[model samples]
Target: MKEDAFCEEGDIVLADASEDVDDIGKAIEIVDIGGQRLVSGLHTILASRIDHRIVVGFGAYLYASSGVRKQIQQRAQGAKVLGISKTQLAEVELAYPTEAREQQKIAHCLSSLDEVIGLESHKLDALKNLKKGLMQQLFPQDVA
Candidate 1:
């Protein structure tokens, strides 16, 4: 009953082989034949598509856009999705400045913020461990 198995690079996966289509949607990189499994970034359709749209299936709608998030949430509400119908998902609506440079700047700023948060988290963990070690040395324990 081991869950969360990892796939190695360059692995070829077969379609409809998974017990759950939702798991296949999230774990596998691509699907073919209108719903067959394929390696991520190696498939023809995905590679050719230029839109920034992300595909989501049933039980796997958690990874979908925030717009449709509410609808999916209403259906399952914390339960993993099993499969999502094509009609259930819709195109995402994003509002951004017309200038390409401004868009790039915004994206860069957000990315930098994420990196800073990650580094701060690591530093905080290290500091907490150091404080625990110091407390252990400062406190005396009675031995019987």
Candidate 2:
């Protein structure tokens, strides 16, 4: 792959193809590449922050937001596999805060919320497992 193909920190990569229309334009922010040459796959659209209009960690949430997703879904066209071209993606309009500090705050808050959700999900799973164990103990299966 060419040097230009390698992605850098804070770059956003979006899925261009998916069987589910709602997932066609899902975006992921690359926070780290582990010091390796990382490139987006053929099925993804790499978007770099060249103009610095949107701050880091914000594009992922921006693209995932309902407003931007609706535009992307409307632009997507396909029967079996939904797809969004670079042109169509470019046509999708998005709004963001002008102040860099505001963008940072939004990203931080969202990211912190995500962390909390993940922790809660883990606790729920553990409780479910404990319940299953208690149920097994309460009603043991008969052995032939």
Candidate 3:
């Protein structure tokens, strides 16, 4: 189904079709949507206006899924390298919590983990910079 849908902020976008299939299908982008950022030149599928009762936190689910990714790769190999159609993308299954409360809990947990990872990553970068500086101090300036 060709989506006549306009992407709004907070919608989950998946590059349903891409020339390079391996790295393309795994990440789900959350549109900070209502921006001047016009996403063109690439085809994507968005899961918008989701029913909280039936599905919750699809963005996180898509991020974690492997089976759907395999299916997308298989589909992409035969289709135009440019991308897959919205209808084909729609057929991809997502596993998400059916209940709203469970979905919130899962989303919270993932958010916390992401925050910790970001902090640790910043620390690692600082340590690397310190090591580089120490190494430079120990060595004389390079002669031509």
lDDT of 3 by residue, 10-76 (tens): 4656765556767555555454544655342255666564543433444645555687777766666
Over the stretch 1-144, how does candidate 1's per-residue lDDT look in tens digits? 122132222222222122343332232232234544333332111112123232211112223335334343333212342443323322323233555466456556655876999999999999999999998888857545
Deviation (Å) of 57 in candidate 3: 4.8
The count of backbone overlaps in candidate 2 is 0
Cα lDDT of all candidates, in order? 0.37, 0.90, 0.62
Q: Which candidate leads in lDDT?
A: 2
Per-prediction TM-score, please? 0.44, 0.94, 0.73
TM-score of 2: 0.94
By lDDT, is 2 or 3 better? 2
Question: Which residue segments of model 1 deviate by more than 4 Å?
Answer: 1-83, 91-99, 140-142
Cα-lDDT of candidate 2: 0.90
Best by TM-score: 2
Show where candidate 3 strays beyond 4 Å.
1-4, 26-41, 52-58, 78-82
Supply candidate 2's per-residue lDDT for 87.
93
For model 3, state the Cα shift of residue 83 in Å: 2.6
Q: So what's the TM-score on candidate 1?
A: 0.44
Candidate 2, 24-117: lDDT as tens digits: 8899998878898898988999988867888878878888899999999999999999999999989988888988899999999999999999
